[model samples]
Target: MNWFKPPVKSLLKLDLQHFGGSTLFELKQNMATLGQQLQKYEGELSQKAIDPSATLEDIKALQKSKEDIKARFDVIKEQHDVLEAEQKASFEDKSNIQNIADPKAKIVTAKAELIRATIRNQAVPKDVMAVLGDRNSTGGEKLLPTTMSEELLMEPLVKNPLRDISTYTNLRNLEIPKISFTLDDDDFIADTETAKELKVTGDVVKFTRNKFKVFAPVSETVLRGSNVNLVQSVDRALESGLAAKEKKVAFTKTPKTGEEHMSFYQTGETAIKTVNGADIYEAIVNALADLHEDYRENAKIVMNYADYTKVVKFLNNGNSTYFAAPPESVWGKTVKFVDAATDPIVGDFAYSHFNYDLDVLYERDKNVRTGIEDFVLTAYVDHQIKLKSAFRIAKVIPAV
Candidate 1:
């Protein structure tokens, strides 16, 4: 004696025309409708079997109806699953595009192209130039590539936040020729005495290019299974890897290789203020004060995430917080976080210069079958942390 519950109908009745063709929404709605019908048929069949006057013919009819509806329901469910997978892939592609600095115009253009192709019954390109193009195409429909979500994909990688907050210049050549510093001190004292011989002194600092490369081996299976934008994904991965290395070099006194660039933290002992018996907020203020007034206006604070969390927890009397929950910034300036083990640094990054070639080169090797294909990405960049004035930056080191 088994009892079956009636199928619940969805209140949402979507119009087919309202949803564009071959869309996720339309497929999902179709699936839901099929499910409701299948459920209704099952419930009717169950009730008929329990009816006292029900004959063998009545039961058999109900069974046949139930089987027919179930078959249709299964087909729609399978379609729904496939559409869901494709929709998920599209979302991932969109996320990758969003991470790029300026992608709105490109996205708009790509969408327009897709629409035009659909309307004209023409072939839509699997890959879009503006964003990473899809690699899988079946018939006229393109399949979304499976790839890691943006959060998980970018979690292990690091990007230089300073790139967003600082000025950038492109170098046409390898070296940047510029005067490092100039000084002219000559005083006029009563035309009687020849003005002290004019004294002019200066030197030049040349920034040269450093070649950086990252080698990543991707399996053919993963590439095909994920259906990811291989070009864009690899580019992003390399860019992030390079930026992380750059950030490390920018903050270190001595880089592992190549020319050493002076870091903001190497401001000498005089420019370093120890947080002795002072609150974190006050310590940061003292650090900013150490910088000249001209540089102070555009100064930014950089620190480790751990220290930043502590700074945000600072409280006023009565345990009231001075900052809004999860403060966006501190000291009226942008705060950038790094994976640094050292103390916080406050300085004007405008004086720090970084130049790079606009072109990025890629080399692919399929013959060197090392179990999978290998991709080599390379970029040329030159960076120098030159402080126009020694007093324009300060480091806040906590007392042991």
Candidate 2:
């Protein structure tokens, strides 16, 4: 479809007199929507054919074209909005028609214009002028300037009566691409520690008497046995009234308690990979040797380690090429690979961006003729992986 040439009248005509308040709102919305649609369709239509093997100069040219179209669309939409609002206001306020002729109206209008002039001179143009215009006053001057017309002075501040209509149209007239893909999740792991203490006690009795014992008492006889098993065995033996009572008892367990020691930790390795490439995927792994190194990293930073095993093969069978992947466990790394290339060309061609604002010559045109191709492999830990992220590539290559 030719987007630049929209059938404006056929698409935009409406019966303003019959449209109720609600319909007027809908019309306003449609105009706003039309503004956006004009820009979008123009952008899509303006896109240039991009060659996959194009050089930096070529890419820049294409970008410049796209940006230029974007700017044009923006300006065109603004103009459309202005025209639409002016049309609606004329329909809604029949009272404004007489203000152009009445002397009293002219006086009020001139006074309002004076204030607007003062404000523009004083660096405050909006507040008082807006209020004066609301009263259908010419915006605050006793005598309006030749440059100041009611319509001209108020054009910027007018509200779009077709707002609702423009909004509906915008909603109904959007253009964008859709994508679908699979997502995956994994697990998290770490190391940790704990403590215990022990206590032991033993008791025995010694013979005691006053400073000078009046008489000597008979010595108490004691029996010896395996007292380790019995808690009260020693006490029982000394306090026993009978002469000798020895019993064998055995304790197989230790008599003390214990507590385990506290545990401490040292920092461990967390390897992350930042992947980027064309047909072939290249992972730039930064071992995150220290906090200092980690802070210096960018979008390539991954939180945890990954194996990053990659397999490369052509979508269709063709000549194979080899390039070295970055060494495993490299910190602060970089990798580059030339993926798909165009068939050999005969002469140096002028290459430019999709916008075609600037062009460059590709010096090594012959070296990459045979359509070199590859893909990248990126393996990241569960925590390191970000879900539902989008990747976009804008490549432009010129034909021979």
Candidate 3:
């Protein structure tokens, strides 16, 4: 009693002009939506063809609809691919400009451009001008140029070893609570009313505060000389001094004077597992097994640079080295090389924590007269380290 009308669907119409303004990501998303709609229409056509009641006219109409949808989808897909290629090329050009490596070269180029813009009395890009700005812009006194500061910060230096393996906390001073459980008796429990009481023990680990300092003296001639790079010199002195001292304290044991500081090796020696006959890989496996299964996920290996190079030279039966090269990983775990680390240290670094009060501070003493007209540079920082548990240290052995 009811007349069946063929379902009517609106065809998708995309504006070719809109592609110029749209980003590559947006164009891709639009193309995906169009493809899905085309699929849905094709599915409907297939369903109608299989229906016994569908007439020859209905089948022909569905086929025409699918062909039209396919044509439109193809055109849009081609446009999206072209736009994506263009976007990638543009991104690479911008990346090249930002990734300029030489600090002096970048500074010279930026300064030259600023001079040109000033002489012509023309407007320069805010980002380019920002590189020359002295103030932080948020507030407070103005400091060095932002670009110079960034260049100084980017100087390569040794990083803290404990930071790679330990649970990091921002707090400088805090009490870390540790708990342990041990089985004293081997008796199995029966279905009776009597139950053996479990023993639980806890201890508090405290990390006291400590301070480290770096000092350097710069001559007045160097500061005044047009050819001398004061920023680079200052940056090198501060970074090198801090890196050397920090590496020494992190690995080597020092007697506790008025201030107590223990190295990672000294704190977790109980977990040490010796490597027999230069089998470093086997020793690392044993060290990992020493850790609780849950803690093993956070485990990492720390070794001296010389020992790391030696391990990399190890060959398998086929003569291929165990490690492909320096700076490569081992067994999917990160292997960090510390030039100052005397022994190989394998542990779940999350158990060791280092806290700092403030980052390195640079102070210039121009008023202090040291007989000569020299600018005294002093750097100061406060930091402390603590080990939460002994199990964190998986192994510590002298490099073979």
Candidate 4:
């Protein structure tokens, strides 16, 4: 049920874009104001009934006025109810934990087991062990809660710049077909029957996902006694570090042994550009122009937050007090300022890809001297930017 499902004129009054998912707030404020108007009309009507000079026409007018406010209040209340339901439904949609049996029971047991990984759930904990028994012959009882899975797996797709743009695949270990650096030189037409297939044999680049590990250290007492929300709270924050590392390597790492692709920020990594222009603004434009037309349309200029500030500062130079700037885009191309990488890169991200089905492994290390146990999570991730010439690397020398 949409809040804007009213008559044409009434719906026109609704500023959906201006408010941007603030329909509920508008409905709430409208209802409150309408309710107040109705109360005012009721008070006026009562006073008119007590006064002898008050005519029937005046009393009738107040009745009509009160009725109008009441009708508006009903409409606003209906809109509020619809929007509230939508919000609740969205939260309900992210339940990957439901894939497991007795999800609620498992979450409860999981929290307890995380506090003390060494102990088993005596009353019979669930199948997180069975799920991983294949990987580890003897598996542990700790299962990540449904809420935690959403934070680590689902949230990063929307929140992390590198993760968002990279193609998400489930294949943990696979060969990516290499991007051909040079075009087939022979332009001579071959007879259709005798045309031989493009003859290169070693055509694929291999990418094996590597395991990333992070730990949250807590005292034995806090683990066993503290609340679920408080103890080992940094478990969720680990995703950011994992995500940052992936992005930096994808966009900057020189190809290691058996790796064929190059990241954008490396010199002559596919295409490299130096600004021949006099000023910083022209340098940015030159970087944008350096990318091939085939890639530039979809390309994003990835830079540091500090570098992006230069664009904003340039836009606001004339306005000392009231200033406005474009929303992180230039020349119709999106500009991404991310925490993961510092050097500027412009490229069509379709050429970049990463595997996504994060399988989180649990481990623990206990220090007898400190009475502290560290809960370590391990996950495997892979990334590559396959296409050459689709990316351009640039370094801007700031004005003196």
How many residue pairs clash (N, CA or C atoms closer than 3 angstroms) in each of the candidate models, in the order given?
A: 4, 57, 5, 0
Q: Model 4: per-residue lDDT, tens digit, 1-400?
A: 1111124455445432223345667778877877777787788789989989978757765666576567656756754654554444335533432343444443433454444543222332335333222243334544344455445655544236766665656454667764435446553423221112123223455566566676666664555552333232544446656666566556655645433343455443233334343444456577678766666778876667776666667766776321233444344567676754555667788877775444566566666787666666676666655554456555556556
Global lDDT of model 2: 0.24
lDDT of 2 by residue, 194-309 (tens): 00000111111111110100111111121121111121222122222111100000010121121000000101121112223332222222122221221223212211111222
TM per candidate comes to 0.50, 0.18, 0.46, 0.56
Candidate number with the higher TM-score (2 or 3): 3
lDDT of 2 at 64: 47
Better of 2 and 4 by TM-score: 4
Candidate 1 backbone collisions, by pair: 127-133, 145-226, 145-227, 146-226
Quote model 1's TM-score. 0.50
Candidate 4 TM-score versus the reference: 0.56
Q: What is the per-residue lDDT of model 1 for residues 271-359, given as tens digits with 9 covering 90 to 100? A: 23333225556677776776556567788877777766666766434454544333444577777777663666676777567766534
The superposed Cα distance between candidate 4 and the true structure at residue 72, in angstroms, equals 27
Error of 1 at 23 (Å): 6.9
Q: Candidate 3 regions off by >4 Å? A: 1-205, 225-228, 255-260, 267-278, 316-318, 323-329, 358-400
> Candidate 1 regions off by >4 Å?
1-158, 174-205, 225-228, 266-279, 316-329, 357-359, 365-370, 388-400
Per-residue alpha-carbon lDDT of model 3 for 1-400, expressed as tens digits?
1222223343344334334456667767877876786787778778887999998767766676567667666766765665554334344433333343444334443433433333233444444446455444543332334454444333344355544455544343566643233245534323111121111222345655556555545565544432223433454565566566556656665634523344654543222333333356556666666655555576677777776555566534456546433243455567887776666666556555544332222334432556322222232222233222323333334465
- Badly placed stretches (over 4 Å) of model 2 are 1-52, 96-400
Cα-based lDDT for every prediction: 0.51, 0.24, 0.48, 0.54
> Model 4 misses residue 182 by how many Å?
15
lDDT of 1: 0.51
